[model samples]
Target: MPDEIYLPMYPGEDGLTATIRVNGHDFTGLTLELEVRARGSKNPVVLSTETGELSLDLPDGIIVHYGAELIEALPDGRQTTIDLFSVSGTARKKIGAGYITIGHAGHMLTASLSIVEVPGIQGPRGWAPLFAAVAYGDSVVMRVADWTGGGGDKPSVGQYLGPDGLVDDIAEATDFRGGVGLTPDISVLSTATLDAGQDADVVLDPDSTPEEPKLRFSIPRGEVGRTPDISILPTTTLAPGQPADVVLGPGSTPEEPKLAFFLPAGAQGLPGAPGEPLLLVVSDTVDTGLGGWWVTRDYHAAATCQYLRAEMLVGAATGVTLAVRKNGATVRSGIALGAGVTTITDLGLVLAKGDQVSLHREGGGTLAGPWVMMVQIDGRAP
Candidate 1:
């Protein structure tokens, strides 16, 4: 074997034989020793028949074996070094050496060897194509291998793969135009009414057999209830001076019930005391020759008064004007008086509480002596 002998081989190849020839004669009775590794890797892998990586045909050749794991570990464009040695017990002798180049299968094939012709082998007779079919039950009866019409009635019967491979279905029929050999039936069996307040139930009849099943509905009857009796009665009375109100009382009787109302009355006021006769007096004596007016007397009414009237008495005067004012406002005026008494009846005035009344006198230019006037007002105050 040459030291520089280079043999190219691919990864993942099995049963590859390399003849171990020494001067045209087989190297017999020699135990195989082989070392394989990537070209530059320090760790080397050993191959032998004991390791199950290679097997030896004694005096013939060495067969190398590889798998997908070796193919992945050794890549294309990287080289593997292989060293072969013959071993007899502990003695080892170096034999042929070479490089195994891992590459694709056809990467190193020569043009002449690439297209080698292969001879054909004889085979059995071909099968004829299908000719006719017809619907029988769920499946169709088909006739095939009838290319030569030797016998007209004799036909092969079988099933075929539908477009999606389901049995007995045809590809050309999109809708169901044929029967499926069965029909379902449904009907109501019975209906029963139960008493009120029971649960409603619906059951399927004939539990042992599923075909032609019937439904049974159980319903409950509704009952009419009694009407409620109602009544409003005034039963309790409240004393006077209490807050006035109406309240609902407890019902009377059990079967024929009645509702009662208790009403309280408001307090009644006492009759007012007899109206008292009230008199408010205003009196003054004035002799103003300069013709000036004087408010003689004023009085505020301490209580409400009604039915008012005024009386005035003048001793003497050359000329004078007199008027009665309520709260400084004139309510009665133009009372002509020279002497004696002048009465103004039906004053038609009501004096509210805190009302002030005054007597005003204006003297004329010829006013003589002291003008003496006394006025009295009367009303009923309540």
Candidate 2:
């Protein structure tokens, strides 16, 4: 006997068979019976030689065969009862039993139905599916044993929905209106005086009427007037050796001041008096067409002469030869001449108040036209 047996079918089609054996020997020559109970049926369908679904062949085996009519009577799942029995004289004994699982022919490709020459008893059937009564749409329906009904009052205006999904109207809200009007009246309340150290400010006056407030402005005294410009005119000479005096002029104004300096020329000069005037004289021009010794007109001295400068001009001359004589004596001589004016100073020559002075000239080489000589003399009164 096998632990499980499978019978293959395609609902109403069949040609399946199985052989029976007992303890490895061919089962023979006894009253053989096969009982098959289809799924969900209360009674088993019995088969025997009397029903022609089981055949007996001595020396071979007893065969249980499935026919089209038998497969049509069974469903596509497990059977609740499948058992084979043998009878001797009047007592029946169970010989083979196992689970009979009936399924579609496609499921048999990966399954095995090892129907050995033996017999088997049937096994427990599988469980069935569960069902429940439920409904849906807008509201829910369920089986409630002891629940009663419910009721509530309707909602009014000025209401709001709450967290529990109920209309609430206990709390109310208020509305607001517009504002008041004002006029455009403004004026100065009072003036504020500030010290030099304080900063200038402008602020509203709180003590004035509420309907029209006033503004107060404060300013520090103007900075001290810019320093006046003071200027003194160039010092004036009053007298020699006297102290200088300052005199205010008529041009003084609030913005500028003008003062004149009356400085004394100072007490009369103490001792050194002025000397006699410097005397300069040019001898009359004499153009010498040739070289020669020339003489100038004699000059009488007005004051004693101590310093003397003598110069002469010659044209086309090689060198100079000139002289100054006082009272017919050569007091200064040996002065030279060149292309331009030639000057010489003589401090050694002295002339008295009535002495006479004269210039002597001697030309060398080619002396041309327009030759002249000049003399300057200065000294104190003797």
Candidate 3:
């Protein structure tokens, strides 16, 4: 008798037949009793056969043929020979690592298999197995108890749902609410609609009395060129139509003090000081027909003084050259004056006793209009 035997049986086959031998002889004419029993069961199947070629109808489960061939019977009435050393497929193959064979109805399915790790199993001497870790693209969703804990048949104590693997979906309500406090650090937020309650415009109450202690005035520290002289006045309450006296403090003197009193209407004003007359002379309008150059009325100095300013005005838009001459010799020349414009020139010339000052113009192009001249003088009479 061979140590192992395999039979290619299918779900729709008639019956499996195998030859039986004893001591290298065809053991004929013998009543063979076959007993089928599931593992861990006390009851044995009761059946018998009466031929050396043993033929027995088997059900789906683990069964022993002639106490040698281990048969794995599938639920669909197919049986295949399985043992420790080899498995029976359409052809016989050896059992090896990283592979598994499953007995099915009409086929023996073989697949590549791998064990990542064996988790620690609790024993009498504590956990002796190695701990496992989740691999990429894989996750452990639940934990099962070991056999040491009351036969390992208890319900799962806990389960874990892995991180969200979905993309492009609305956030959970809790997550959305929690994100209200999140602000982007580097990015600018634009085109966002804000609630009316969040508007930043604040109205201050004008009628409410302000406490002095709550009022703060600050000047920021930087280059303000110079420290300004500021004076705080004493608090004063004035009645209606009552005038307030503002006294000038010591350090609060202005560079130019402004006169406060107004002159009465129709009051005659006194003349200016001797050397500072308001106006020396203003010439009447004069016309220069299309000439290249024309001279104005001669101005004789009445006082030995300095000529301060001379103002010339023309009526039409034409270019003109102006010159000031003292006794036929030119004192200033080549001064271009535009027509229809008023030109003011500061002379600062010291006129001696009886000095002659005259004005001349050149190149008045067809401008038939009046020219007016005004002079300002400062000093004493000759």
Query: lDDT values of the candidates?
Result: 0.47, 0.49, 0.33
Predicted structure with the largest TM-score when compared to the true one: 2
Considering summed lDDT, which 10 consecutive residues are worst modelled in model 3?
Answer: 258-267
Candidate 3 RMSD computed on C-alpha atoms after optimal superposition onto the true structure: 28.9
* Candidate 3 C-alpha lDDT tens digits along 1-382: 1222234433333244332211222212323333333344455433334332234232211221332222332222332222211112343322211322235455433322122211222233332222222222322222222223344344332222224522222221112112235442332222334444453332223432333112222223333233233333332334322432223443444432211211111111222222332232322234554322344333343433333333443234356556656666666665555433232334434454456556565555433333334343334221
Comparing 2 with 3 on TM-score, the higher-scoring candidate is 2
lDDT, candidate 2, residue 270? 18
Better of 1 and 3 by TM-score: 1
Q: Model 1 residue 345 lDDT?
A: 47
RMSD of each candidate relative to the true structure:
40.4, 47.4, 28.9
lDDT of 1 by residue, 145-194 (tens): 24443333443434343444324444332232355655557677888999
Question: In model 1, where is the ten-residue run with the lowest total lDDT?
Answer: 109-118
Candidate 2 per-residue C-alpha lDDT over 1-382 given as tens digits, one digit per residue, 9 for 90 to 100: 2533333333322357654433234455557777776766667776686567877665446555667655665676644456767766678776655445445656541111234333323333333222222233332222222212322332233332233332333222111222456763677876777877679888878865657778798978766545556554554655433543445577887456665655333122112332242433332323443233344343344443455444442224456566666667776666665555443333455544555566565545433433334344445321
TM-scores of the models, in the order given: 0.23, 0.24, 0.21
